[model samples]
Target: MIVLHNVQKKLGMRPVLRHIHMEVKKGECLSIVGPNGAGKTTLLKVCACIHQIDAGSMYWNGQDVYKQLTEYKRNLGWISHHHFLYENFTPVENLRFYSELYGVKNCEETIKRWLKIVDLYVFKDIPVRTFSKGMKQRLSLARALLHEPSILLLDEPFTGLDQDGVQLLFHLLQQEKEKQTAIMMVTHDFSHIEKISNKVIFLHKGEIAAESVQTEEKHIKEMYKTLVDER
Candidate 1:
């Protein structure tokens, strides 16, 4: 499980996240939603340790993440709007490189499995620069999941995906949830929030304005409009 207590962050002098508190247990999916510049991506980046927090603490399984940053990062997987692939490398080569970097055993088999899972097996030999945006996104997902990290952080993962790609991603997320991987996503895709996430947080102006658990009667969309749109 991952927990954040009164977490705060800033870019230069502008505060991006302020006094945020949240948690995602094993096997749970939490979705962060809000309008543009609501600090949604910043929150995810903070969780991924890409951006340092100015205050508060982050814990992974009861230990302070900063105390064991290297170890803690080993269990984390992140996917962002940028694909982050080596454009000159083929899909197989890219995965192979990441696999080796993560010290994944059976590198060949693992690379092959993820390629098939993301439906990129057919293009595994082609350089990533030759692929379309949707193809690159799929490869990026494969790269993030290659080592099967315990926690997954995604920022606008569904961007540039086609219907088939979206369905594939949904399927992959479901598989991850079933495996007890904690998932946190920042996205504006409201339509599928209820389907994939068990909890939702409405972030506005760097703070959590409202939150909803899956068991709640109010739909996520309704809460978004009430807390985010109204303000």
Candidate 2:
């Protein structure tokens, strides 16, 4: 389980997140939704330990993440706008590198399996620089899931995906959830939120304006509109 206790952050002199509190247990998916400048990505960065928080603390399964930052990162999987891939490396090489970095056993077979799962098996040997945006996104997914981390953090993961790719990602997320991986996603696509998320947070100006456990798509849309318009 991941827990954020009174989490706060600021970019320069402007405060971004304010006293944010949330938790996502094993097997639970939490979705963060808000208009631009709501600090959604910043929150994820805080959780990922990419940004130093100005205040508050975060924990993973009762352990202080910062105290064991290196060990904590081993259990974290992050997929963001940045693919974090080596442009010169082939898809196969990319996964192989990550597998080794994560100390994954049977790396050769694991790399091949993930390449096929993401539909990149045929292009496995091709350099990533030549791949399309959607293709890179697919490869990024494979990279994030290669080590099977306990927690997954995603930022606009479906941005470059087509219908088929979207479905593939949906299937992958479902599989992760079933394995009890804690999932936190930041996205503006309300259409699929209910299908993928069990809990929703409506963030407005860096604070959680509202939250709901009833994740019906229609209800979420309505709530989002009401909250945004009121602020």
Question: Highest lDDT, which number?
Answer: 2
Top candidate (TM-score) = 2
Provide the TM-score for each candidate, comma-separated: 0.96, 0.98
Compared with the true structure, all predictions reach lDDT values of: 0.90, 0.93
lDDT of 2: 0.93
RMSD of each: 1.5, 0.8
Q: Over 4 Å off in model 1, which ranges?
A: 215-218
Residue 226 accuracy (lDDT) in model 1: 82
**Where does model 2 exceed 4 Å of error?**
none
Taking the tens digit of each residue's C-alpha lDDT, what string does model 2 give over 1-231?
999999999999999999999999999999999999999999999999999889998998999899989888998999987999999999999898899999988999999999999999999999999999999999999999999899999999998899999999999999999999999999888877978999999899999999999888899989999999999
